[model samples]
Target: MNKQNKHLPNFTQAISQLIALPSISSSQASWDQSNQAVINLLSAWFETLGFTITIQAVPGVKGKYNMLAKLGSGHGGLLLAGHSDTVPFDENRWLSDPLQINHKDDKLFGLGTCDMKGFFAFILQACQQLDIALLKKPLYVLATADEETTMAGARFFADSDMIKPDVAVIGEPTNLVPVIMHKGHMSHKISIKGQAGHSSKPANGINAIEIMHQVISELFKLREKLNLSYQNEAFDVQTPTMNLGAIHGGDNANRICGHCELDIDMRSLPGMKDQELVSWLSKALQPIAEKYPARLTITELDPSSPSFQQTPESELVLTAEKFSGHSCCAVNYATEAPFIQQLGCQTIVMGPGSIDQAHQPNEYLADSEIIKTEQLLAQLIQHYCF
Candidate 1:
């Protein structure tokens, strides 16, 4: 197929345009911005390159889209996947416009420049050098939505009819290292309901605040059990962990505390399941609920992202480690790789720039890192497709 029938943005223009377009994906409604513009920009570029472009609308998320651009067709191929959206930025804290590409100290600073709309630009640049005719298997450029928030785009794509490649790479800033395993994220709110009464009449009503202490104690116990049961030395944090994020209860000191709510955050290891943990929690709190005649309920804040692990021996992981010259390791953060892995493709998270730059004020991808990424991706393409 003929490539670049029409003009396309060079690397600089591509990065600038992607950054200028606001595609902030946040759980807060006010901070959230549609990723449609980013997808459309990518779609047009892929179309110019003679790629078969298909924009899949994420089912319940209005104005959100997943762009899948195919360069060739076959049973197996290489997939360069990344999220189009970035985390909400603190504009006041930034030295320059967060939505504009600013260069300083040999770095390109902007939202999504590192964590990772810029990834697609490098991928596209690499593809420009690779002839489509030389590809025996498909080379797909995929951009998904809401990775900073819910990962809805990745979750939807996991079940979609898109081609399942034999190997996949998620461009989530890992400083050019190959990450084969990462922790999963899950959060919940536990609400305890009880009747209110005067402080003097302690027997008249159940004190939710008092009982919540017991609940918290039980949670601490559960956390210890979880920590002891699951441990992977590969991760910086060697065990599955839980945190008591927030809590709220009754009104004043004079009134007996009637209602209490606790929000929790749990990071699961590869072998652990959030559903099973929640079930255990309910069972553990059952006695307390019965003893105090308090109604205890547990509800999820958002869908859990299951932990992902690609064995070091897997071809994808080995190839990534070889190309990047970094040993396969684990990251502390969660990513879209787990969802992509569910499709049966051996996935590795390897991309340009350091993760410390992500979600921080004045985020950036260094010039050296960008060039290194382009060269590395070109080599990967040659090895996998040529």
Candidate 2:
């Protein structure tokens, strides 16, 4: 049961190489350069392994690439998907260099080591060990860009005619458990406009901030109502939840504010549609909009497709469970699973590392987890590809 010998050394090397590049999604300059570098390295590696590779670009971001590498051919194959972007990090906050993989006490400390790069490393290592001649069906590795910020890469891939398999595995950190279901997150900006006037004569002018408060109050009541109405046993929270993440208004204390804005974060269940929730909010805000000379606008930010729910009996779930030797469960976090699921393919979120380590300052993945992930991936290829 020596874990190091069970997984190939190339997986560790891949993790080290990936960690060397600071591909933080929010850092436009770093992301632009690092994304292409990572893709180029991966393309060369995959091509050497005798897999066909393709690189697709995001519309606005130059040098940001999405890579697809395919081995073997036919239906009912497995698609391994992962994002190449990491969240922004401050250099001063870390104990070690964030871009350099630091090994201590069987843990790998580095940015992007856990959030996603580890899974990509595992996939690369697994593919290198497989013989293309023995594969019965195609195996595709899809590495995407901007998953942390906008999910633009996943959205683009979902709409394309690229190699869609019968099943997909989203390599988000899941502690190696198969997440068959998860909630979808919807972010929106609510803006209200009204007439500005002197504070003494508040009645003479419409107070946008006051109107916004009223609307927000009504929205909170609606949120409570929805929370009470819908129920799902699979999810930890039985009902959808809404939070006003941020709010801004009033340029000066002396003058009545003419505009106000609030950012809303809504988590929708598997069965609930985002449009339904938007419609309900619109209806509730209508009265406030009519009472004052106010304008209400809702701008969606990173509107997710929906939450994915794979059947417990699905082959993909069964395969993942067998590989991990553990029972699967549902999670509340959103992922790229739903968009991949739209291709008539069952998708699951399964990978090493805990979700808690994803967006923190000193984000790192346990070296033992990486070793375990590498072995599990190798087993998957041996079982499904051979």
Candidate 3:
């Protein structure tokens, strides 16, 4: 079971190599980088382990890629999946290089160490212990791109239906707990255009900020409606919520405000349709748009991440709970599970590291999690693929 004996990199080495490759996914152009390097590294390692490597260029995305490494072949098996990209990190906030794996305080400190290029490293180590020839069913390791931003990689791969497994496990830093449910996310931008004029002649120009005030008022009412309409006791936030994340308006105190923009984020509970929510949002703002004529516009910021929920009694959930010794729970964060589940596989989010550490400066995974997660992955492979 020793990786060194098989001539493959050990756990620390694997994670270190992954950490060294900066595959950051951000909506901002300056922060985003290609995930092809990480994908290539994973393909090389898994290829060494006798898995067939399929490196797919995520359609329409210039530099993103998804790696699907499969061992053996069959209709049903285990799929260990996670995203290849990490969120943007701030170097000044970290005590050590965020791109290098620093082993300190019994933890592996680095960007993406736990959320979750480290998950791929764990998979590689676990596969090193297994005999691929004995696998009765296929074993798939999926590395996707843009999970931190639009989740376009997962959406493309899942929609293609290239492969299907009986179960899918997304390693999304859930602290090794079986996460059966989580909310979805969608962002919207509302822009208002108004004529500019001298501040003394307020009537000569349409005030975009003043119009935005009415829009905000209506948005509050919509939030109240959502709170009253949806409730899930399983989540800490029992109802769907919306936040006005950003607002920008005109610059000068001497001039009338000519334009304004508002960015909003909505998190929906399971069973709430994304389009339906958009429809409700449009309905709420229709009056303002009508009153303002061509001055108001509402647009979706990016692809929506639909909420995900797996049944409590499902086999995958039960198996995960049994193996991890924790009951299935819910999280507020959105992951790629919903799209993967679209392929008709039983899916759950259970992985090493705490979500609390993800995306934070000096993010890390406890060294103890290495063995524990490797063991758990090995057990799942034995049960599902052997």
Per-model CA lDDT versus the true structure: 0.88, 0.82, 0.93
TM-scores vs. true structure, each candidate: 0.95, 0.93, 0.98
Tell me how far candidate 3 lies from the true structure as C-alpha RMSD in angstroms: 1.0
Off by over 4 Å in 2: 1-9, 27-34
Tell me, by lDDT, which candidate is best: 3
Please give the ranking of all candidate structures by TM-score, highest first, separated by commas.
3, 1, 2
Give per-candidate clash totals: 0, 0, 0
| Model 1 C-alpha lDDT per residue in residues 128-209, reported as the tens digit of each score | 7777767888888889998888899999999885687888899989999999999899889999897899999999988888
Q: Which residue pairs of candidate 3 clash?
A: none
Cα lDDT tens digits, model 2, 1-386, are 11233334477688899888767687355544448887887787777777899899877666678999998988768888899888888889898998888888778889888798888888877776676678898898898988887777888888886766877888898899999988878888889887899999988777788888898899989998988898788877778888889999988988988889999988888888878988888888888777764388878866555767889999888989988987888888888888788777888899889999998877888867866787888877676666
Among all windows of ten consecutive residues in candidate 3, which has the lowest summed lDDT?
1-10
Distance from true position, residue 316, model 1, in Å? 1.4
Which whole-number lDDT from 0 to 100 does residue 248 have in model 3? Answer: 99
Find the candidate with the highest TM-score and give its number: 3
CA lDDT of 182 in candidate 2? Answer: 87
